[model samples]
Every structure is written in C-alpha cells, then in structure tokens.
Target: MDTNVITPEGYAELQQELDTLWRHERPEVTRKVQWAASLGDRSENADYQYNKKRLREIDRRVRFLRNRLSKLRVVEYNPVQEGKAYFGAWVTLVDEDDQTLTFRIVGPDEIYGKQHYVSVHAPVVKACLGKAEGDEVRVRTPDSVKLWEIAEIRYGLAAADR
Candidate 1:
C-alpha cells in the first residue's frame, strides 16, 4: 500500500470519525440488528436485513480507517516552507484572464467535502510545488495546458486569514 500523507488537522478529523463509528454507530447498529433478529423470522425482516447491511458497511469502514490511520503520516507546517507553495500551503493563483483562485494543497484524504482543498498529487499541485509567489506555473490537463501565476503563498496562518 502507498503511504498515506495527511495534514495534522485531517488526521485528527479521521481519528474522530473512527472513534465515533467504533464507539457509537457500530454499537447502535449492532443493537438494532440483534433486536430485529429476536423477532424470529429473518427472511422477511426488513429491519434485520437493513441493520445487518449497515453493520457490515460500518465494520468495513472501521477496518479501512484502522488500516489507513496506521499508514498515515501527519504533516505539520514547517517554517522553512514559508514563501513557497508546498504541502499544506494556502496558495492564491491568477490566470491569464485575471481570474483568481485560491486553494490549499493537502493530501487526498483531506480533500473530500472541501472545495478549497487540492490534493498534493494533483497536477496543479505538482506544478506549484517549490514555486514562490509571483512565479508562473503550467499545468497540463487532458484538453489543454493551463497557465497560472502564484499570487500569494501562506502557511500556518491560512485559517486565520480566511
């Protein structure tokens, strides 16, 4: 398995989700499944079937989380990363059309549900890595190559600034 890279905040979030699933959700679903099974006929027991499926899904997720968490390396902000686009850096870009876009470079595990988070493995991030503010970056997409200028780079203070 590939090493899972994650930000400190993202790691904490995943840990919290795992805890919730293990301590609360899984137990609750298991209880429901047991109660439904006690009603005797499971062939047509909707509650039992539903809860059983839910339990399996929960267990699968728990297993995945456990394995993933073990492999995850939480990335902390480094002072040396200042003034350049690196992992965990908040970068603002301007296109040739003067359109502004801002996003933070984070690991794949952190990008879900966050529109402003870009995966570190993305082509745009690959282009932005080691680039300082005012540097031009080119990202090759399936259709065309996109050009952007790094307008700003900030680390550690991104949340406060936003």
Candidate 2:
C-alpha cells in the first residue's frame, strides 16, 4: 500500500487519539461489557448487546488508526519549498470570476473539520503544484475547465503571518 502524507500537527493528533482510545476508552468500555456480562442472560440483556457491539466498533477503529498511522509519513514545513505551491503551503488564488479563495494544501487526513484545507491530491492542488505566485493554473472539473491565477504562496511562519 502507498504511504499517506500527513502534516506534523496532524500526525501528533492521530497519535494522541490512538493513545486515548487504547488507554482510556477501550478499558472503560471493556469494563462495561464485563459488568453487563456478569448479569447473565446476555442474549436478552440490552446493556450486554449494546456494549458488545460498541466494543467491536471501537476495536475496529483502533486497528484502522494504528495501521494508518504506521503507514503515514509526517511532512514538516520546508524552507526549500517557499514561493511554490506544495504540501503545507498557504495559497491564495483568483478565479475566473475575479473572486479570491485562500486555502492551505495539506494531506487527506488533515482536511477534516478544516474548510480551508485542500488535499494535495485534489485537482486544484495538482494544477497548482510547482506554480509560483502570479502563475496561472487550469483545473478540469466535471463540467468545464476553470482558470485560476496564483495570487500568493507562503509556507511555515510566513504563512501564519498572513
């Protein structure tokens, strides 16, 4: 399987979530399952049935997270990537309608809960790769091709300053 790319912050967040699930949530749920089981007649026990299902779901998620984290490569900000659109770059673009959109190019895992974060594999990012400020890019959508101009590009501390 291909390794997934993740930002340093995103990597840490995943690790913390894995630790919490393994050390805290799993144990608490396991205790509930045990308590429910001790009441006997598990086939008719609502608590037992519920907890058993919940435990399976939790374990599945834990396994998936562990495997995903193991295969992820945490990408840190690089000064060498300055002035061009790349992973972890904050980019501003002007669309054909003359409207401006600003977003950060990040990994697939980092886009959750962040409206302004675009995945590196997204068509817009693919079109913008290796493009510097003032460069034009073409994005092909299902309906038509759209034109966008790179208004600005920055990385690391410089990106935060903007």
Candidate 3:
C-alpha cells in the first residue's frame, strides 16, 4: 500500500489535469473575477461572489495537483510482473457465491472517477497482490473474511510494445 506509487498512465493524467487547470481554467476564472469586481456594487454582486469562490477553488486544486504530481512515482509495467497480480494489473476474481468482480489495481488518486479501478490500499487488492491466476485469496474486511479465486490477471502492454 505504498501511497506514492502510481501507474504511468495515471501520472500522465494528473499532469494533464494540472496543465489544464493552470493554463486554461484558472486564467479564465481569474478574468471572470476581475470583470465581476469592476462592476460597482461589491456587496450584492452575485457574479463577483460566485467567481471569487470559484477562483479560490481553482487555486486550491492547482496547488494540490502541483504537490501531488511531484511526489508521485510513475510505476511502469515490468516483464517480471507479467501473469502476476501487481500494481496496474487487471484482476478478475470469483467469490464463493460465484459472483465475479473485475478491476484494475491503481493508486488511490486514480480511483476517484473510475468504476473499474481499485486502490492498492483496499483490502481486496492487498490480498490479491503477488497472487497469480487460479490462486485463492483470503480478503478480510471490517465485516467478515471472504475467499476469492483469481480467475484472471492481466497487465497493459509493456512500454516497449507500445
């Protein structure tokens, strides 16, 4: 559960977001705030208040993205990790009830908007780490312990292949 580890694609995505917020979005909000402020009425100006709040939010996100991008380590796929459940692995597991769940193991930051992604810090992912296809994994959650069989383990194409 190394919080600093992120897939190469995840890192690139974060970088792109930072670039967009800094280069495009922030400047637009700043201009809006200035234009709103120029309108005489300060107290009842809805545009000024709203755009000012948006400017603060954008600045906060830009600062956070800058800091997070600096500390993240982009983990590229390694040949040794092929066929094993590791970071950036697409894992499929079947439970005792025969229900199947599939997700890609990624960093905590990358799981926010992705339904098919699970954080490495999650209990299920922790149990599946280093396991191979057809291996049985015991996942202990706050509610109960469950058994899952690894049905498939796949990784994205290697960097060289791309």
lDDT of 2: 0.87
Best by TM-score: 1
Over 1-162, each residue of candidate 2 has an lDDT whose tens digit, in order, gives 222998887788889988998999899989999999999899999999998998998899899999999889988887889899988888999997889988888889888887788898889998998999999999999999999999999876343434
- Order the numbered candidates by lDDT, best leading: 1, 3, 2
| Candidate 3 vs. true structure, TM-score | 0.92
Clash-forming residue pairs, model 2:
none
Q: What residue runs in model 2 are displaced by over 4 Å at the alpha carbon?
A: 1-3, 157-162
Choose 1 or 3, whichever is better by lDDT.
1
Of 1 and 2, which scores higher on lDDT? 1
> Can you list the residue pairs that collide in candidate 3?
none
Q: Which residue pairs show backbone clashes in model 1?
A: none
What is the clash count for each candidate, in the order shown? 0, 0, 0
Question: What would the TM-score be for candidate 1 when compared with the true structure?
Answer: 0.93
Per-residue C-alpha lDDT of model 3 across residues 59-151, encoded as one tens digit per residue: 899899999989999889999999899999989999989999998899998989777888999989999999999999999878888999999
> What TM-score would each prediction reach against the true structure?
0.93, 0.89, 0.92
Least accurate 10 contiguous residues by lDDT in model 1: 153-162
Q: How would you encode candidate 1's per-residue C-alpha lDDT over 1-162 as one tens digit per residue?
A: 223888888898899999999999999999999999999999999999999999999999999999999999988998999899988899999999999989988989988887789898888988999999999999999999999999999876465434
Superposing every Cα of model 3 onto the true structure, what RMSD results? 3.2
Give the whole-model CA lDDT for all candidates, comma-separated: 0.90, 0.87, 0.89
